[model samples]
Target: MKVIDLRSDTVTTPTEAMRKAMYDAEVGDDNAHEDPTVNHLEDLVCALLGKEAAILTASGTMSNLVAALAHTNRGDEVIMGSKAHMFWNEAGGVSTLGGVQVQLVPNDKGGRIDPADVEAAIRPDDVHAPRTSLVCLENTHNQCNGSVLTNEDMKAVADVAHAHGLPVHVDGARIFNAAVALEMPAHELCKDVDDVGFCLSKGLSAPVGSMLCGSADFIEEARRWRKIVGGSMRQAGVIAAAGVVAVETMIDRMVEDHAHARRLAEGLSHIPGINVDPDDFQTNIVFVGVDPNTGSTEEFTDRMKEEGVLTAYRGGGRFRLVTHREVGAEDIDTAVDRIAKVASEMRNAR
Candidate 1:
């Protein structure tokens, strides 16, 4: 049987075009800003994100870390959703390297952080308080079932942050997915924020890399942070060349992935032991709640793996399945069938 991997979009491999671009790319020392291909990729990303400048990083985690380190001072605090990738998935790099504290606002099931809650979370100007230097938003929030934040929602958060003279950074790792879902331009999704970081690896099908885009001065500072974090690369155009193709070709195809996710969610919902809200399905991520009577999350996932389908079990009974460039509609159907069979077996076994 063919294996279907629904684990994450990050598992996507580069395309044939990307491979050719990588092999033919021009190169120079990127640390000196002399790599022509890398420079083009940066310029292209800046144009796409509507920022004055952009810097390429080795990974999305590095992009967020560099942006965080650049936006805030040591001992300052950054406000974001409690379920944010920065707060949960990333290895606490901001607090570890940037010496900043995190203040979290509650995130709704749809991944929206209430602007009022954000305002309340900002610290007052006092001697004893840690200054609230930044506010962060995640568009196409990963942990929140791949919820897409609207431009108005982002602007509302930015309005509150700006009133207090705090900059906003968007952890836009899956931003293109948001843009495609909302039928808006990618840059519009991030226009309200001071800085934005997006992944070229996920959904876009690039082998590796992310971009941090912002004002020229902010990026210059972020470049320093990148160097400090040991992210600066010489002749990085080898990978950046593939990134160029991703930006040019991969974005428009995300709608297919979104549709596949919806189909998967719909199929899983029909199965007896799986609980999923197809209406909550928006982007490429699907969250399914497994019945405790059926099995533990780990047990369900392992059984699915045995059936030649892979998935991730988030804490609690929630299992996450993500659709990407590689997985097609047929694959989603196969995964749903395999998962349902496994869940049914567990229920029968009990």
Candidate 2:
């Protein structure tokens, strides 16, 4: 049986075309800004995100950390959503390495942080509070069932931040997914923010790389910070070449992944012992809630693994299922059937 891996889109394999591009890539030292393929990929991200310049990083986490370091001085506060990936998942690099403070605003179920709350959270510079230097947001927010933040949603917060003399950075790891679901261009989606970063490895299906886009000065500073964090790569065009192919070809296919996710969520909602609402899923991630009568989320995940389906338990009786390019409609159907069977057995055991 073919294992249907629904843990995350980060597990996607690169396309054959991407492999060919990587193998045939022209190379030079990226640290010297001489890698032609990396230069091209940076230019593509700049154009795609409507930024004056861009820089390449090894991962989305590095990109976000670089952005934070570039935008804030030590001891300055960075405001963001409470459920943001940077805060919850980035190992506190900004706080630990950059000496920055994190101030969180509540994110709604749809992944929007209220502008009023953002404005209210900004410190008054009374010498007792840390100065608010930056605001961060996540598009297709990971913990929020892949919910998308509209440009207006971003702009509202941006306006508040800008008025307070603060810059905004968007952790756009799955930004293309947001653009596809919103039917908006990537440039338009990110225009309001001072900096935005996206992963080429996730929904785009590239083997590795993330791109950070911003103004020329900002990118220059971010590049310096990236080097400080040991993110500078020599002769990195091998992977950057695949990133070029990813930006050129893989963005449009995210719509299919989003559809598959919705199908899986809808099907899971119908299954016994699982609690899910199809309407809660907008992009490629579905959060499956286990009822009290059902088995533990970990137990269910292990049982699904035995049945040739892999999933992730995201704490609190919720299991996350993400759809990617590798898994198609048939795979989703098979996964749903097997999962429902497992749920039935678990309920019976209970």
Model 1, residue pairs in steric clash: none
lDDT, candidate 2, 1-350, per-residue tens: 99999999999989999999999999999999999999999988889999999988999999999999999999899999999999999999999999999999999999999999998999997989898899999998999889999999999999998998889999999999999999999899888889899999998999999999999999999989999999999999999999999999999989999999999998888998999999999999999998878978888888999999998745798989999999999999999999999999999997
Q: Which stretches of candidate 1 lie over 4 Å from their true place?
A: none
Instruction: Give Cα-based local distance difference scores for all models.
Output: 0.93, 0.94
Shift in Å, residue 350, candidate 1: 0.9
Question: For every candidate structure, what is the RMSD over all alpha carbons to the true structure, in angstroms?
Answer: 0.8, 0.8
Q: After TM-score superposition, what is the CA distance of residue 162 in candidate 1 from its true location, in Å? A: 0.5
Query: In angstroms, how far off is 20's CA in candidate 2?
Result: 1.1
